[model samples]
Target: MVMLDADPAGYVYRVLDGPLPEPSRGGLIRLVGVFEKVLPAISDEYASKYYTQARDLAALATEIEAMRDE
Candidate 1:
């Protein structure tokens, strides 16, 4: 699992390079939903910055999935 403040992109790349199961991999969408729920609830600027980073990480994960399907 990638920590909220850690290098999420790196974690994604590593997971992609390994023998991850299909069902577990499909959970990325749910992960994005988690971030989506947290984003709007954030009122502090500092926390919001992390929320944006989480959003980017979620996007990166989705993009990887799209590229894999191509």
Candidate 2:
């Protein structure tokens, strides 16, 4: 890893030796996508249940991508 930027205000940004590996479509992101497709099949009584899990996973994937050096 290496420091890519810094400031007197104590802010800094870092990056690894190279770009972060791309997330596979058949990976976490894909899993979330699959879950979304499942939602429509679920009855309303259970729609929220599946939706929450899918939403949380999607948020997690976003957070992880944000942290990686793009």
Candidate 3:
């Protein structure tokens, strides 16, 4: 989840280091669902940004699944 500081006039978000943290099973499911809806309407200008976010979410999911195999 993206978080921001509580400032009425300014915003500060939390940045993760290295890789995106894996969401819980339920959260991942929700992310996948949101992506399904968002991908179709993504325009060319923002495609690269959204594409990277989508890829990161997918990668996080994969990493989580792999950890379960251990």
Candidate 4:
């Protein structure tokens, strides 16, 4: 997984290279786009449930960045 530092400007675009079915590729792209758009709106509870660490916001951001980079 690729990890990136978080910034106020948010995530930058990441190019992905590989063979993937059209639907799967599209779904991944859609998920990243949606997350990028809604991330700032995510509540603490939601982040906590998925991230599981109280002080791991940085790690969570890294995971999201990696997803975008995938």
Candidate 5:
């Protein structure tokens, strides 16, 4: 789950506890990339949300990397 600010400006929380379906990973990565690209241009409110989302994406990526390490 992902939560934005009260005004839907920035990202606040992201939770990834379960397995992600194969088909969704690509799209998810794409979305994360888009967010990373646009984050700097947005308002502080939006940037905040983007920051959290980006953090979540980074965490997810790290998890995947660790899986490959195994």
Candidate 6:
């Protein structure tokens, strides 16, 4: 089962406690790379709001990588 909860601050994506399927894993890898590549430009333009978003993305990427390893 997958559940998504969203609010003004951010979102939470909950899924079964196991490795993600290949497609999802691949998508996350790409997502992380894109965010990393764009974050500097985002910071330069958007500043604080984008910094918070970047921090959140980094945290999510770390969690996804740990799940992939498991």
* Predicted model with the maximum TM-score: 1
lDDT of prediction 3? 0.43
State the lDDT of candidate 1 residue by residue for 1-70, as single tens digits. 2455454554476557863357745666666777777778879998899768767876777777667767
Q: Write the per-residue lDDT of candidate 4 for residues 1-70, one digit (tens) a residue.
A: 1121222113222222334345644544554454455555657876634433322443343456456567
Report the lDDT tens digits of candidate 3 across residue range 21-68. 454444444555655566566567666465546545554554555566
Q: Kindly list the per-residue Cα lDDT of model 6 for residues 6-46, writing each as its tens digit.
A: 21112124323455566756655555565556556654554
For candidate 4, what is the TM-score?
A: 0.37
State the weakest 10-residue window (summed lDDT) of model 5. 6-15
All candidates: TM-score:
0.68, 0.43, 0.42, 0.37, 0.44, 0.48
Q: Order candidates by TM-score, high to low.
A: 1, 6, 5, 2, 3, 4
Cα RMSD to native, each candidate?
3.3, 13.3, 8.0, 11.0, 6.2, 6.7
Best by lDDT: 1
Q: List where candidate 2 sits over 4 angstroms from the true fold.
A: 1-26
Number of clashes recorded per candidate: 0, 0, 0, 0, 2, 0
Scored against the true structure, residue 9 in model 1 reaches a CA lDDT of 59
lDDT of 1: 0.67
Better of 2 and 3 by lDDT: 3
Alpha carbon deviation, residue 12, candidate 1 (Å):
1.8
Candidate 3, after superposition: displacement of residue 53 in Å?
5.9
TM-score of 1: 0.68
Question: Candidate 3, 3: how far from true, in Å?
Answer: 8.2
What is the model-wide C-alpha lDDT for candidate 6?
Answer: 0.48
